[model samples]
Target: MTAVNSSDEIAPSRMLHRLTVLIVCLVWPLIWVGGLVTTYDAGMSVPDWPGTYGYNLFLYPYKTWLFGPFDLFIEHGHRLLGAVVGFVAIGIVIAAFWKENRRWVRWLCVALLLMVIAQGALGGVRVVLSDRTLAMVHGCFGPAFFAICVILAVVTGRRWRQDSDAERLRSSTSILTPTKKLAALAISLVVLSYVQLLLGAMMRHVQPTTSAGHFAGIVSTHILTAFFLWAMTGLVWLRLRRCGDLTLSRPGGILIFLVAVQIALGIGTWVVNYGWPSFMTWVPGSQSFLVQAKGFVDSMIVTGHVATGSLILAVSAMLCVRLFHRRWQAKQDRLVAT
Candidate 1:
């Protein structure tokens, strides 16, 4: 196998790379929660952007912090977390610029960093303009940014760049056209997940208050898109299972399981609570069976759903990267043998 060597002086797989990946993965969930904080109209709970109560970020007033209300604090905390994510993104991008093997990979990281900055600005715009449209667009971009980070992490991981020509030639000998097909299905599932995420952002922006036809349309569209996401995930899993590639197939199986649980929680929240509270929680202070069901559905459910989406996307991309690297190795081997 031809090693994927860098012309640059620095290498990416050092301890810093792993740390960066870990940080990005951890930040992804916070990004989604930030989206929710805005989607639920909680952005102005503190009546500020980028800061709270005239203090910068972490230095907000203690009284305001501990007041008889928690909405502002939640929003402020989201902003603070976003700032941390931004710093981590910048660091990772700079690391890529100096250390990555491939020139294209460096450029990709640069583009993603720029997008992150733009996303941060959009958050400010969403606040200053008080425009739901801007808020919705910002919310939608958050997941895309998170997905990019996930891709970066996957690329930096051990299994990503390490391809074996010997194994590839062996794999190729097994009539693994089915494996290629599974790779395609994995790519499709990732794309569909992004689409579903966008639809969800749109629904959040609409925040339908009444049982009007428009609200029902939004709800129906959201639910149906979710179903499509689930179906696409199933296709990914099925193709991977048939491919018989244990590495790719195993991760695909885990992703499918995550999707199943995510969909169940989604259904429970929507069908039982009509998607109230806008926070993925049960109706507050209610003891009814419906509220109880919603509460059970709420805790960890939304977080799990978003987190799982990011995970599935990361896993799918990793599988594809493996396939392409293996193909490159195989082609190289055949030339050497000839």
Candidate 2:
């Protein structure tokens, strides 16, 4: 009886861990794919808001799969993936309720599930209303949801949990110390990166052809924002190096590398569309080379961008927490040496 009880208790914990991992993995890639679909104006390809054709998910027209291939596949595929993620998120929340020991973690899991559902609803409205604003808002939500999921995964990781318990983890294991200013700068960069993501989504969602002039203006604005993003990331790295903490410094270096790669992709997109007449050639009625390249780059960049953002945010959070938490440890070490 005792053995059976122990086994049963372990089952839920393992199940919940698996579910959390599933949610985090799905959330990030889906956000990138969702961004791609939006950039291509593939959202309305299905011509139905929540369902494929007139049928539900599995019942969607077989023709969609075979005859006269359409944008419907790309768009609808994205929606179907989104639905799968939503279900997984709910499973995670439910698992949290049953398996998690902490009340706050459970509540956060519940809240995250609710947020994913709301994000799905927002996606539907973006389709039904056909509003670019709603589409941008929906796009922004994907990354935000992904970030929260990433945080949840990190908190539940064995390493993080072990660090929480080990006094050695809390000790002055670092020969180099970080100042408060460096930590603050890291936090600021993370926040700014998120804002840049929102702007990128907006630029992708808005119909530039309607007002070619206006669209061009917005594109320029987007490019400028990208430059600022690069600058901010560089500053963050410089500050971390100044702190002389290689632990933080290495991830900062990685982020800097990712940002450079993203910038190159962004410029590649412009070169591909060099002769294009309009920014949003990818919209349903008008698909062009520029549109296709934009679609591909948008897909590739957004996914990488979101994943990089998660990395930046996670690293920043850890750096800030450890810098603050280690202050007393640093002082204690100095006193003992004296």
- What would the per-residue lDDT of candidate 1 be over residues 1-338, giving only the tens digit for each residue? 34443332233556436756766766666765674575345777766666676688778776776673655756776777777777777777777766677677678778777887898899888887888788778766776676677667666665553444244456555534345666567677777777766666655567545457877686677778767767776777676666456766776777777677767766654544453434535656433334433332363465455555655565666666665555555555665565
lDDT of 2: 0.64
Off by over 4 Å in 2: 1-14, 61-63, 66-70, 170-172, 175-178, 207-221, 238-247, 274-338
lDDT of 2 by residue, 112-133 (tens): 8899889989988878887778
Regions of model 1 farther than 4 Å from truth: 1-11, 35-40, 62-68, 164-180, 207-211, 275-307
